[model samples]
Target: MLKVQEIRELIKLIDQSTIDEFTYEHEGEKIKMKKQILTAQAQTTLVQAPVETSPPALQKNTAQVEIQPGAQQHTEVAAPQVEEQRGENLAEVKSPMVGTFYHASSPDAEPFVKVGSKISADSTVCIVEAMKLFNEIEAEVSGEIMEILVKDGQLVEYGQPLFLVKE
Candidate 1:
């Protein structure tokens, strides 16, 4: 279990980072947070409900609540699109958890696998560090790495594609 302060800090970090969602589990307690954007219709519903209850008092407040269409836009971020363009069969190695992706065991060491490097099913392709724990991510499929979708030290979310492999 995480403390309240720790959870607050985690939320703050997620808000500041580019990650869309975060999930953490410890001893059976799991916490997940996702960034949400309110649609224009939803925002209007939220503001209109309170104004209808109090007419005079919230008359000034209603004027201040302006619902601008396409003002606060929400753009969907696309996941890595490292599909095989050569028509060869390809497999994706996705991240299992949300964390900082590391290409090597250490800062000075070489990357575990690069483009054109052949890997087996159980090969350790990368590491994801979450809350001081280093998790070894496996290839899960035998193939040659065709493209690395993420850069070193990049923050990745769960189910995000890390590499495209030619199977």
Candidate 2:
């Protein structure tokens, strides 16, 4: 089995090379990767919803999104902007794979981490359910949990930031 760091290194290598696809299998574990080229305009699909209030200033934003390739999902543009305003001192704990994020192991259980909670690199921050498999996500960075980006049971995409930690 390959470690996350190893997989990340492999991705960097594959991305830098001219190779469009790569696959590897070992010990019943299989990994496959592919790259797709998209034009700048086609890469983003922005949607602006009608304003509910009579005033434009009242609404936070008209609504804008940057759609990912192969996934038509659109997220609020303000989230990232808010993240940026929070400052660069914060480190993001991103999702390794697309799945439903769960702060706790079960609905009735207490969450793994919360705002102001201190965490080590090995601490379990949350769980993501993908294909019925519950995968535990680590904090990976030693810091205090500053923000929770997604709600429990919300569907998250690959590489999407889940939590922000202040180191």
TM-scores, each model vs. reference:
0.51, 0.55
Residue range 1-167, candidate 2, lDDT tens digits: 56544554455455556776677767655556565543222222333322111211222222232223333433221111122223767888887765789999999999999999999999999999976889999988888999999999998755578998998
Candidate 1: misplaced stretches above 4 Å? 1-88
lDDT of 1: 0.63
Off by over 4 Å in 2: 1-19, 22-86
lDDT of candidates 1 onward, in order: 0.63, 0.63
What residue pairs are clashing in model 2? none
TM-score of 2: 0.55
lDDT of 1 by residue, 55-140 (tens): 11111111112222333212222122222233558888887666899999999999999999999999999999977999999998
Model 1 weakest 10-residue run by lDDT: 53-62
TM-score of 1: 0.51
